[model samples]
Target chain A: MKIEEKDVFKSYFKNLTLRERAVFEGGITLGALFHQFVGTPVSLKNREILERSIEESMKNQPCVEDISVEIVGNLKEDEYVSLEGKMLDVKLKVKVENTVAYLRLRYIKELNYPLMYVERIDEE
Target chain B: MKIEEKDVFKSYFKNLTLRERAVFEGGITLGALFHQFVGTPVSLKNREILERSIEESMKNQPCVEDISVEIVGNLKEDEYVSLEGKMLDVKLKVKVENTVAYLRLRYIKELNYPLMYVERIDEE
Candidate 1:
């Protein structure tokens, strides 16, 4: 699982949009490395902060928008781990103000996939 | 092009989401077959009417919603047909009231892809 997570992160770090890549690099250099040593995975709160900082840094990119990312289905919880025992078919419904987009992914361990990264490029 | 179109449509007609399939079957049996002889591909207006009628019939399904499906790119027009010779890369942004979903497809000839067919299912 750790190897999979590391590989996924590495790929994302390579292919992230210019603005996103810059933010990721800056954050890692500044504090993320320290957090890793201290045993803290980038929390939702920290992620929001980083996203906002990145958004501000890249004027061409869209602002860090607040989106609701939820997992809906029958779930089985065991202490710190909540496993979705049922067919892990998850429907991600993302709404950016008046505009809404949906996606269906199955058996996803990590909730944060690069495709779902909502930092806008050009609105045409 | 005709073969490709026919094949794509055939798949869609076969996999028409239960309610949609019923509506399509009923329409073809009643009038679509008749229209085929008269040579009329389902027009936007007629599609709207059929969509509405189907919506009413399938109360479980979302009502026929009007959406703006626009092709945004520098396009070159050739008489009755406008060809987007600019790499044939099209971004589809579909908005349903407060929700908007987007997809990016390259080298697409047919404007009416079945995946873009927005007859609503359950809202979770």
Candidate 2:
């Protein structure tokens, strides 16, 4: 049988090492990102660049490649418009060895740039 | 055979629900607290009070109480001596239902108070 990212994510905590999960407590508290607001028709060009950046960052994590892992992180948009811009959400999937991890996040705008803030990372 | 907290923490990520683990990534980054510096001979009385506070916070978390969870948050000291103060360390253990979780943290002096900053939370 073949395992997928969703499977790895299902036991999200179990798939990772003990050291990895222990750090999660702090991660849950610290890695919270709110929504973002940028100009109209946010450039897909910018989004693609950022998506690649996120993927690279995830791949750079320790032991990610150790167990035959595959990560797919996408930036999704939310429906909230005002004087600001738009709010983008995330859907991240990671398959490690025989486990899978799928999570979500948020994209917020800073003074002049966009930041992909991790909202929450868990399986549904 | 009886399972202990150590056993649960060994598979820290695997034992916890996906949703729980997902929130941990953000928690790891956001819940980081730096060590604090108060007056001389920091009162153990204050430490107990703070420890209780931390336990309450952990207990209040969702799904924690669902299982048999025993959380022990302690304030340990470091060998950092200066005109300032001492740094404290933590050893936390949580038993969620059947799974156990053990993690570490740091206690730093802020302004004039003590703040418990989660260092690296993982079973070692």
User: Per-prediction TM-score, please?
Assistant: 0.16, 0.30
The alpha-carbon lDDT assigned to residue B96 of candidate 1 equals 25
lDDT for each candidate structure: 0.27, 0.34
CAPRI band for model 2: incorrect
DockQ for the candidates, in order: 0.01, 0.18
TM-score of chain B of 2: 0.33
Give one digit per residue, the lDDT tens place, for model 1 in B50-84: 43443343222122222222222332333222222
- DockQ result, candidate 2: 0.18
Model 1 ranges with Cα > 4 A deviation: A1-62, A77-124, B1-124
User: lDDT by residue for model 2 over B38-120, one digit each (tens)?
Assistant: 22233334555544554554444322321121222343454322212224344444433544444444333232322222222
Per-residue alpha-carbon lDDT of model 2 for A1-124, expressed as tens digits?
Answer: 2222333323434544543343353243222212111222333335555445435544433223211112223334653222121243444443333334444443232222222222333332
Model 1: which residue pairs collide? A99-B100, A100-B99, A100-B100, A100-B101, A101-B100, A101-B101
Model 2 regions more than 4 Å off: A1-102, A105-124, B1-48, B63-88, B106-124
Model 2 accuracy (lDDT, Cα): 0.34
